[model samples]
Target: MEWLNKDVTIYDLINDHYRLSLWGLRCINIEKTWGLCDEKKLSEVIVGLIDSGVEAEHEDLNGNVIEGYNFIHNSRDTCDEFGHGTNVAGVIAAKKNNGVGIAGVADGVKIVPLKVVNKNGKAHIMDVVRAIYWAIENNVHIINLSMGVEVISSDEMNLVRLAHINALKVAISKAIENSIIIISSAGNNGEDSIDFPASLNSVIAVGSVGVHKVNDTFILEKSEFNNSGKKDIIYAPGEDIYTTFINNTYSHTKGTSIAAGFVTGIVAYMKLIDPKLNQEKAKELIFKSAHIISNHKEEIPFINADNIMISMWREKVNK
Candidate 1:
């Protein structure tokens, strides 16, 4: 194929923080997967970022952001008042090789900035459900949810809470039925339980892994604040991640929220390479290609972007 011998290096990797700020990207081996396809095709992959909102004018995110609705105020303005959405968007699609800020995992993919949360970092369950249905209607390729409702004790589960959960589940089911990949952060609570939406069976759950240098070599360790569960969860770099911030600036943040963005960015590329890819196949490839952080099978595996991309590439060509 044309991409096999394509000059990948032509795509700039020299953004100001490429070396220093993008420790998470390096950990996932994201650079090796660049230039694997036509940049224009990659641009067609859209990720619906359901969060507070995005600063559309942010230097690193301006052109890469697509129009989306603000469910909070029922307006067109998606400016991120809380700044969390901008952080996650930066982790997923910050401009590459701008020689300005840090680069994202999939620089070519466009982000659909859906505002489901408010400035106080609070989101209504119905708002999130509406955003998912909106994304399904818009036919986005992926949905990256960096926010979720915390899991409460079983004794506290009430009919109202269950009804809300079911509402989100139904919306998520419709998205998946339309072949939209939904990924959510496991949680930042550091508990053994995953958060809602992510805890849903069909959604891909992502946890945070901290990158540390041990004896001059980097290692992936589970972040203390990353929530864990027994099933269908993966890990990615989260600690000290430097990405785009509001006000056309940048900052370092950490959480499973950032981790979910990393997976979403990688999955965007996978969808680009294999348009036929769906939730089941994407999750299979992700879990199968993941690197085991420890010897235990139950330990959440960290994402290996290079491995999964190559696997997807081979599958595309083999067919």
Candidate 2:
């Protein structure tokens, strides 16, 4: 509560951003609803925030951040102008129980902000490609991409406008070759398909789930804009999740973008438990720990971050 910026009045700090973020914490079991992970260990993972930059000086995130790049403006200032990147990073690694704001899903991991999306919320495909490579070169353990563009094939790499999409294919493939875990948002179109990168085989496509109360039965329904398919898709709480915002503030936003951040946190925490964990093994643990939201009506498998640690313990005891 001390570091909360003076600009963010004490009342606003508790009412706006921090208080309502409990959905994400509960979904990930940061509160230990299942009586797990008592120690709250610090993780060694370095997560890449590849979006609209971040407010590196924010009270909740300043300490855990590393020097980042701004591919959009080609500068050293990675401060967020659009607020989305800070929000995503806050979901992934905002310091826990900091008194001023809500905790992130995986605390203790470093965040490397890569400014790909611009203040206008428009990002060139080439900018995104360069940011991914920059993050890879910096040796970040995981790259969380919450944005995507239409697919472009190798044959169409010279459309001037569509060229970057093709180049991104190679960039993404190289990142995977180096064994970096890439987690992306399932396209927010309310269709059965995701966009490129997310639809590709190499990345974990994340979809959003909304906590809905209908007719006295609680239902974890898909976000209205969530895109779904069998392509490595995972669902997490995303609808109107509260997160850090620019100007030392907070707000609630919706879509698969928020869901992707939670999944990235899960990956980071998994790596912390087992330093040798790779992209393939992490995916396995996540899928194995997922729970079916509604088997009788909806078959969406929602992630239970609390269960992964429990599963690991059960196996250890059985041995």
Candidate 3:
């Protein structure tokens, strides 16, 4: 609610629940049929959730929430003051097979909460830079950034470049070679270009797509909140999306933020399956496996978790 000003109706919430249920079913079928990754063993990979914070005590997230840090106040508890972080976290690693709430895209993975933004929905470049550096030092496999700045700063851009270089070097060095995948939201500005690091070549920029409730399929039309162009890499369910933890309880919200989180969850799942995969390979796999939907005869690539996992498996077999 901190980021969005609109209110969600009950109808939207029910529709989201329905779509999520279908998505969960598809994921289960994919996993069972292809042996994507051992659900029991996938928790070994630690993914860094860099955002406001996480509702660590949330019933659906408590078990998977591992180590966490608060760069905002430099304290221990990274409890989500704003509900955005919790919603993002839930998308990434909310415990699956619990038969309650909702299933995450990568429920098998572990999360390392990195609180870079404070409760007031504000964050500084220095804190974000520090958080990225900390993630690098801590051996976080994938970093999910659901927040961004209106104007790109030299220092912040430099930090993102540094993180990308370090990740590349680490991948090549073969020493502590964990691929650091950076996923960012393609800001809700609905401009011709995306924002900040997401616009950068190194980060995976995600746009949003609205799905029709009646058929449970992506609405081919793009939302005004979505950012487009070459920088806009992929799209996901972001409009009227129902996620865990509202302002205080639970409700539906919409933005490119959720789309980025959706992609982050898929990336986490990919990492779990092939821990040896490099960042370049991961990025390529995501793009290659995306479901290209046509909007007025124009192809719009959207995130496809099942396709990505299958492609990775196929690559492994071929090799």
Candidate 4:
């Protein structure tokens, strides 16, 4: 999908190329899923999107964006140059009622854009660590990381441990004082083990799932670039998923990135419902409510957002 310029319109693409109908089945199902949760009301929470950058002024992401920072260049405007971050951000909280483009998973939530990568779609380990520290310092309720590095360093691992401890402490304190949640993307390398941060016991590791045509079964699969393991990874819709606002245009990108955004949106909604919910409880809610899809029962596990949200609502009402 080539863009006319940096300010292309969704209507222009639709009228010229017919890109919207490419994934007709998936688009229809996504619309249905949005319709199911629209009545739940998710406007009261804040979520942080940690990635390359975001198009904060995009029509579908205007008022929903709160504040943003770029750790790559240490700037305040975390604008998208690689377009990956904008797509991930749109998945979490693209504004609704715009009557132009597609809606996000959590339309009402506020997005705190944290840019940690550069235009080449690369980020340094120190930059990511600083971004995490910044997110924690800023009291971000939920942080979504869509990027991953293959090699892990001691310093990086130390930072990961520090983030995990900080997350746990903050979550516990929040449960006792305020209530917060943290979510991270399960890496995109399709391996037998999980990566850092996501592999950390504190962060929620998210995996990818594809709707396979054979036998009508939804397969909890890993992306070719995802590192796999028996870590605390949960699966979400990740294969060939449609995201929003790329290079000032709309496009579909596949990775654990979108899946992590999906989970971030849900966690934001959950926080909105129960402000006192801690990280552990939130994780428990996600795991206990997730739909099981594995046959062996010993391999990695996956999650169904629709089911998990329903279960959370039921639990809330029961309580």
RMSD of 2: 6.7
Q: What is the C-alpha local distance difference test score of each model?
A: 0.85, 0.76, 0.68, 0.65
lDDT by residue for model 4 over 1-319, one digit each (tens)?
1110123233332322323432322321233234445434565566767787888888778878877788877789788888888888777877644566665667778788888778898876666667666766776777787765453555766766556545644543442233446666777767676665576676687877655443554444445566676666776667776656655578877777787877887777667666777878878878886655544233444554555566667887898
User: Residue-wise lDDT of candidate 1 within 1-319, one digit each (tens)?
Assistant: 1212234332346555454657677678666688565666778899999998999889888888989999988999999999999999999988877777888888879999999889999999989989999999898999999988887765788988788887888999989999999999999988888998788878899989886555665556788887777767888889999988889889989999999999999998899888878999999999999977762223557898889988888877897
TM-score, cand. 1: 0.92
- The C-alpha TM-scores of every prediction are 0.92, 0.86, 0.80, 0.76
Put down candidate 2 lDDT per residue, 1-319, tens digits, no spaces: 1111113222332332465555655554433422354324544578888898889888888877788899978998898999999989888877765677777777677888898888899988888889888877888789999987655465765677565666888999888877788999988888767877798877888999887667765567777787766686888889878778898777788778889999988777666666666777777878888876663457777777767777766765786
Q: Pick the candidate with the highest TM-score.
A: 1
Tell me the tens digit of each residue's lDDT in model 3 across 1-319: 1111123222222223334433422322234322447777767778788887888778678778877899988887788887788888777776655655765667767888888777888876667777777887888888888876554444766776556544533332331244677888888987776776677676787887765432443344456776665664777777765557844345577788887878887777677777776767777887887767664546777777668877777878998
- Where model 1 places Cα greater than 4 Å from the true spot, the runs are 1-12, 153-155, 213-218, 295-299
The best candidate by lDDT is 1
Root mean square deviation (Cα) for candidate 3: 7.2
What is the alpha-carbon lDDT of model 4 when measured against the actual structure? 0.65
Put the candidates in lDDT order, highest first. Answer: 1, 2, 3, 4
